[model samples]
Target: MDFPQRKIIHVDMDAFYASVEQHDHPELRGKPVCVGGGKYGVVAAASYEARKFGIRSAMPGKLALEKCPELIVIKPRFQRYKEISQQIRQIFHEYTDLVEPLSLDEAYLDVTENKKGIESANQIAREIRETIFEETGLTASAGISVNKFLAKVASDYNKPNGQKTIHPIQILEFMEELPIEKFYGIGKVTANKMHQMHIFKGSDLKKKSLEELVRIFGKSGNYYYHVVRGIHRSEVKPHRIQKSVGVEETYWENLLDEESVFKQLKLISEDLEERLRRKEIRGKSLTLKIKYRDFSVYTRSKTQEMYYENLEDFYKTAKKLWELRPFDKPVRLLGLSLSNLNTQEKKQVSVQLKIPFPELD
Candidate 1:
């Protein structure tokens, strides 16, 4: 099957949260820093300096401290991060409106027919990176390729502040040498499973027949079979509708009692409320996620007839659900999410035309 050629560029901010903290506080530029709470909380974002000591996001703060005693921890300023993210998104609009945001710190852009009518996706990526640095004083890395998957993988090849282009002619050779673990959708668990099967790299994965892959990994195996052959068909959706909105946290210390548990829930509810209000979003269903000290997870959901979007309403329902939760084990994590959002999908305009590619150097 032949598909129309497309130009995709994945742009990822370098050490986003930590870089933002450093940019705002020049004194911390060269020092090892992370945006997270101390001792009891987890590392949210570790700067390259802290990464030198093997510190990473989601690592327990105590462990991070053990690795680097001089690591500076800063509280996350989400509002400030959002402000800067908006500024960056504006810059993307200048080149293309077909931008699919993966997160506040990264996005995939389809510039096959960009607003600027730029033919070279590599040039678009380079200009975007330079503009991001100039306007926000933050570095971004970009990957330009014929598809989103290749572009996503290429973006990460050069870190902090660099760009990599995966030309169409280089696709097969590139995929063959790439590690299975480095594939965008392949998680650690899946990668380990593939390793046990001696499928350690893209070359090894490509050896498996479609029937064999589907039999082992189910529907996802189909995705694996196609992507490994340099055949990813998913388009970059500019107006991807979100189905749910959530906020979760793993506490440094376990919530040993109902009072502590409810207290944490209240805090989480407040945060969720602010997020919903910021986006002016409401949902018909609320879900409460609980993780015990033993790491066992459970969820309880309640649906209301009418859509609600207030902290009081969210907390009141969440408190009731907690009261009836099973097994009163010390809670390790608590989360609240609103699903069945009142989001209407916008009409999509599709362009199906083969595009010319630039020659690789």
Candidate 2:
């Protein structure tokens, strides 16, 4: 039997941790404050106020302090954040059980068959946003799209109490002007590479043939092509324990050959594979990690549409990755892992297996 058209919603709390701080501490409201940085560390969360002053998460405490000398820095209160996350999760459960959390501050919900029987998924998202604001006093942005890729992208189209819905027909147009740098998997390095190739926006990326993109970008290019075409086939699955599981090993000697690297990585992969079997888990993403003679490190990963369960599968994925080393240095350490999980979720794997993308591939 054919199923009803699905509705997926991506919700992100506005500056979640920092916003929470502002909500509880009246003194912090409307002022620049960072929710991390106690003695010597990094910023975990930056208020919009802090962002305005060039302060951001992961900026060194020293640099963040320099950016905004008046920045009010506070240690993270995980208990409070967890409590709030549970509260928001409760809100999500009120509508659908097919909820996947990206982190403490973000989640994706599949409500095609919601308890509320709402015909319009956008309306459900809107109602959830209103409930969150009234009950939790926090603002969230919602993105609604035909698939997870577009839904995630739509969510970011607006922020801080905003919502964006992209119908399937509108998906292609919506991505045309999107900056390459802003694409979820494209990071600073890849964006620079794409810029050098005269691909600055999604339109530019779309202009390239999939084969050409594969020549330049390898496996990720296929996803890039599909994303621009708005043909992403990933789903919105129920929340689970882990999407990724991994193990790493460090060696005293810096090995210089591909054979040695693969051999060592094989050992790591074996343990990981056994664990995966024991847990009855499967994954689409595989990562091969390496540390070079100069102590520089790089990781390459590949995610297939299907999850893998065999050791040979992981080894092949790893070997392919090892062959793709563009800059080879003596290997100092190596590791392996399987991720993109859907633990006990009893739902189809979504495009989320598409993430953890920065690895060496």
Candidate 3:
């Protein structure tokens, strides 16, 4: 059976948060800048100038300054970021309704049947990039291909302010030459595991049988097989509601005791509650995720009949799960997530707030 060819484009904003800062503050442009909480907190975004000094997002602000003493640190303005993101999304909607946003800074667009009646996907990508820069004074990179996976990978091939198109004929050569680390969804640990298995590149991955890949990598083996063949069937979804909202932190020092664990959970619970309040949503299910020092992960979850929307309730559930789980080793990471969300809506008035229309016969 033959599937219809698709024209998918992946657009990624270049250093979104940092770029926004530079765009807003002329003095910060062309200088090393880091947007984050503070010296004690983690770096949320780093400008390209800072990246040259090895400063990166998620690095501690103190460490970033050490790497580049001239680095100018600024607090994140999430509301401003969201506003810019909405503007970028509006630009995406001009061409295609089929847009799947990966985050505020990037998205996948299915443009096989676009509103502009454009025949060339490459030309469409160029136009989109040009328009974004013109309207927002920001640069974006685009990758065009027949599927989501390839398009995403292609988008990163050219760094800030560039675009790449992988034609159908070029897919095979592209896949074969691609490094294992370059593939999406393959993290550092997974890449290392693949290296130990003598799978250093896409060419090596394609040589493995499906059964062998599954036995080695579990369910994800099937995904790896298909993506290497340039066959990703995931569709672009425009109105994608989040299934869960969660936050996690990797400690500078491993958490060794139950007291420390609970203290951290309490803080995380507060953060989650604030997030829920901001989103105006509640959840029936709560989950606790713990990662040991060696990178092994474990999760415990509970689902309630009624929705919960407070910090106390979340803390209670998470604490119970933590106490029940074995903790022979120190913990490197901790997270709390709420799923099965319920968004609060205004109730309809029983009595007419205004004059009602006359009943029809």
Candidate 4:
């Protein structure tokens, strides 16, 4: 019933984009700040001061302004963020090379065999957070636990310059008391579905049989079944392969007519072609993603008979897919991605077992 405890740490930067702006500009410090377009675009990142006014990333800027009249909206400086992110990453490499970046602001690190030979994961997390702040002037929160899922969940427990460690002894009690929505990877829709099934918390989810869960959630039911019992076996893959290449843009104004939509698609197609060519990869499948003004998304995909690497071919297929689907609302975002790429190689993952309840405890 017992297994080796692997130390995993999830490091999440606090308000990365907004914090960079605030750190660079002293005048913006201690004020409600967000990084994104003003007036029409969505908030890319909201500072803690802005978060106090219920402003959050991806919220429409108009709504964010209404919530905080004095909010300062700034355009994102991506290159600046990247520079800071690289500095923080160097700090991570000092401790462990088994680092998997989730984004510019977050990463998973397996410090079980860290270069520093530190024995305690909690101490490593503390040092990492402190070093990130000292070097980048940006605060980070970290979670340390026996596995990725638990470590990711624990990281959020303490926010903006805080850290938490979930020991093996606390895993069962922690999962039991956790809300279903609090479980990492369970999105809003899935959480709502679980609510309808009376699976409000981990304890409630634990009562469902594997058959019942699989019947309701399909293959994901198996995932939920295992993760809820602290059985997430997925490792920190440092060199995860790129599954798809795509580009998307959000408009300040909605495209109400098909002509405008097509123009945007053409531009996106051009970008996708350049991206694919730059990577020296070709794909058999192309996807068109449309996000309506109401924030609902719809996608259509086409698989060509042969791999394609040029704009002309993919654009034709994208346009064909667009003509096939009927739009229900004005469009705000459009994107194109190439998949089933020639660069991809098939790899099989081992099936995880359903461990007994006693194993986690």
**lDDT per residue (tens digit) for residues 1-361 in model 4:** 1435899999999999999999999899999999984675789999999999999998988899999999998977877987898899899999998888777888889999999899999999999998888888889999998888898899899898899998998888888889998888788888898889898999999999999999987778887888778888878777645667788877767899989888888888888888776667788888988888777888999887799768888778888998887866788889998888766463521111221212210
Model 2 Cα lDDT, one tens digit per residue, 216-270: 8888888888777776666665633566777765554457676787787677778
TM-score of candidate 4 versus the correct structure, residues matched by position = 0.80
lDDT of 1 by residue, 1-361 (tens): 2444899999999999999999999999999998884776678899999999999988878889999999998988877998999899999999988887777898888999989888899999999999999999999999988888889899999997999998888888999889998888887788899999999899999999999999998878888888888888788776545678888877767788888888888899999999887776789999999987666788999999999668889899999998786546788789999988876642432212221111111
Residue 114, candidate 1: C-alpha displacement in angstroms: 1.2
Most accurate candidate by TM-score: 1
Candidate 3 residue 43 Cα shift, in angstroms, is: 1.9
lDDT of each: 0.85, 0.79, 0.85, 0.84
Lowest lDDT 10-residue stretch of candidate 4: 352-361
TM-score for candidate 2: 0.69
TM-scores, each model vs. reference: 0.85, 0.69, 0.75, 0.80
TM-score of structure candidate 1: 0.85
Q: Which stretches of candidate 1 lie over 4 Å from their true place?
A: 247-281, 290-298, 309-311, 326-335, 344-361
Clashing pairs for predicted structure model 4, backbone only: none
lDDT of 3 by residue, 256-347 (tens): 99899999999999999998787677889999999886668899999999997699999999989998877799986799998887633423
Stretches of model 4 off by over 4 angstroms after superposition: 1-4, 37-39, 188-200, 252-274, 292-302, 310-331, 345-361
